[model samples]
Target chain A: MSVLQIFRKTIMAVVCKPIAHFWFGLNLLHKERLPENGPAIIIANHNSHLDTFLLLTLFKTNLLHRLKPVAAADYFLKGGFSSWVSLRLIGILPVTRERKRGESDPLQACYRALERGDILIIFPEGSRGAPEEMSNFKTGIARIARQFPEVPVIPIYLQNAGRALPKGKRVPVPFVFTAIIGEALTYPGDRAEFMEQIRSAMAALKEEAPQLKWPEQES
Target chain B: MSFPFSLPSNTSLTAIVLIYGLLGLASLIYLFQKQRGGGSDELAARLGSWWVIITLMIVPLMLGALPFLLIMSFISFVALKEFLSITPGRMEDRPIVVAAYLTIPLQAFFIWLHAYGIFLILVPVYAFLVLAYLMTTYGKVERFLPSIGIFHWALMTTVYNLGYVSYIMFLPGGCNGTAGNAAIVLFLLIATQLNDVAQYVWGKSFGKRKILPSVSPNKTWEGFIGGWATTALFIAIVGPMMTPMQFPESLLFAALMPLVGFIGDVTMSAIKRDLGVKDTSSLIPGHGGALDRLDSLTFTAPLFFHLLVFTSYGPFAMSCS
Candidate 1:
């Protein structure tokens, strides 16, 4: 609601949309895989920054649920203009993913958002990986799902986001892409079994989508 | 029972300009509200400015019917081009199919000449038969027929839909005629757009059951009914003033408008899903693109136009009398 924020959003609504139209190609398929309401976790592989916008477009808002994305705090939550632009203007949530795993909780805020009956989008790979492969998922999403077993954990594949804005690249290259795919994994009560299910579900997501790379094993 | 009257002297033209300016203001306010927290695209702002300017120029020229029709025809041409560009047809058969793009201007011209007789037949019967014949004669039947046929049908709908709306505005009532006609157009535009907004609002507030989980997940039964009910109420209030119909009759028309408009919205949604696009293009701010704008028009225009025909031209008058 700040004046500068107001000014910036108007420009995007008018300016960036046309350019996005010419550059980025967004395809959403089998959107029926995600349920329409309540306590669902959307898990997708991370690739490019533009993945955020593409996901938002795929997450249509009618009257019920509005999709909120969990962005890395270090990158998008730097305060001032950038944070305002990313969080307030673009409707994304910023989480500190760079925090030490045991010492700090990266997904605490995300879990809080979920507990509050909000839709959460988590990039399980933890960081943006090359389009060729998905990295190992952080265990935090599983823990959150375990705590709230009733919630559906939806898996999504974001095709061609890496090409749009790859790691170490500032400029975006337009490659028409699809976002909505993969079925939601219903939670089983056991933790180890659930993690295995998640891993397998994540594998199947990458299997059918041969275009995307499987997650590299942790070093 | 007559609505308050007005003549198109300098005062009325000035009034028209002011009303248009207010509409520009309304669009801005709408953009601000939706995009307040979200970052705005510079492109959307620039295009929106252009849209406002065109709207300003367009409404005043509506002082006369013929000039108004010409201006509208030009808009339809631009709109149709945008539609074709987004929804690509056959690749190899581009040459012969491109001629169909000519139909936009041709239909406009026919409308200008007030040749309703030919205008009605030019697309559906004649154009369809001819386009089908051309595809078969060329013997590229396997590869090109379907795309060519789809392109022809799309063009036909685009022209027919837009022309129907323009035809309504051009009816021979003179400047004062515009006031009454504006009411009809306004009623349709308002009802449809409000339904879209209401569905979004209601869905956000209390949506649960998904209507079409695949095509549009956000569309809930509650939201749809809520939007329809609200739109019906708005239509009932405004309908009689715009048309010669009575209140109950107007209510009936208003009740039907949103259902048609919702269908138009979903039909376009299906197309966007096929094309894998978010918006048709970034033409309209807060709104989306030409197709996004025309989605409602597709249903609203033909339905309301025919409704006008039925009430004014058909046997309804005798029964009412």
Candidate 2:
């Protein structure tokens, strides 16, 4: 493992696990549905920076290196300490959100990362809104899904993470988060249909959040 | 080996055996029900958890005061963490959250030192002023009063109240010749916990009228009366044997402790009702979160300690430190 990988592992083990699981309380469901190997895309609803930490901590320590988050280039890749943390520590596959005029595609980094068999974490909502409140899903994830038809699209509904660490908040208040990982989705039809499918899938996850049965009883 | 506070080793050993024996009886009931093809998974799970809980309580107690202190503080940590996570927080008052987490160990440290003077007032006096001031420093006026109120309240219930349970070790023990300090802790724990069980049993069997319909529908007057009588009787019988109290004082402690535990339970329910979530978190499989389990204890511990101090510790000066 590389030095940065070791540092990331340490953070996941020491800091992130306690803050994300114990302190913030990540009650993960359907975690077994997550593919052990990648060439996979983990799409989630955007809410808080805590979403990234919570998701990153889900993978095994050795597999931590292969887990890469697909974030906005304009925001995350802007040079300095944040860029360093995002690019190196989190290992985000930075994609320029704006339409750029060039022969090269904006999602080139994501495509390259996927081709290399690295699991990409994508937020279809593009940006965060109010806590636990979600907006319309962007088509960027659908395109990624269509391009890599074999790659599994895991829809994770992170409930209450927005309350933990929402946008513009540097310090995170302790709030329990529930990350509901849905079953793996493959590109079913065209881009728009796939987009609609995942969107409704997330909505289904949200509905199931309250009624979902947990085997937490003593018996 | 001698304990920091005098709990006669033999007395505590007997307490351990009795606790284990109770656990064994529970297991046997579970087994019998299984044989009759009427075993519930919930009962099995509850028994499994009780086995662990009983063992955890007894072993640390045998080890000495420090282990018990560690267990109590850990519980406070989990309970506080659950409280903070469940409640909605303002972004501007984020620093105060960190301060809240910091208070757990600091309070525990005071207990380790047996610095009753500082331990008694640290959260009430210092944490109150400092946390409020910390919120003001952020200079965000939106919901300042409510945020401060919530922060201080969280600290009080989770850290301050539970800290009293650990402080019981330092209570000047008048019964040190026969009973150990462990007996006092066990007495409070048993009375409070059994009161909950007794109340649930009574409520299910004969509960007719509701106490606080909107707040906690399950709590009925019958359950309340039955639980009080049962807990008070048990305390009166056991307190004289284990604690430094006569029958009447034991009865008094019994009457108040169970009542206070009920308050704690309902208060937590009110918080849950507002938050729109059930069972703080699933830390314990059978029993909600640590906070859920400790809710009554949080209320009972402080009252139990103060009652002991008022009756036994204050006049005794030094019993067996």
iRMS of every model, one decimal?
Answer: 10.8, 6.5
Most accurate candidate by TM-score: 2
Superposition TM-score, candidate 1 onto the true structure: 0.52
| Tens-digit lDDT string for candidate 1 (B243-280) | 55567677767778888888888887877676555665
Give TM per candidate: 0.52, 0.79
Candidate 2 C-alpha lDDT tens digits along B124-144: 999999998888885899767
Q: Spell out the clash pairs found in candidate 2.
A: A218-B45, A219-B41, A219-B45, B7-B180, B7-B181
| Residue B111, model 1: Cα distance from true site in angstroms | 1.5
Worst 10 residues of 2 chain B by lDDT: B312-321
CAPRI quality level assigned to candidate 1 from its DockQ score: incorrect
Which regions in candidate 2 have their CA more than 4 angstroms from the true location? Answer: A1-19, A22-24, A27-41, A59-68, A72-120, A127-135, A145-154, A159-175, A180-219, B1-8, B24-45, B55-57, B173-175, B204-211, B220-226, B315-321
Of the candidates shown, which would achieve the greatest lDDT relative to the real structure? 2
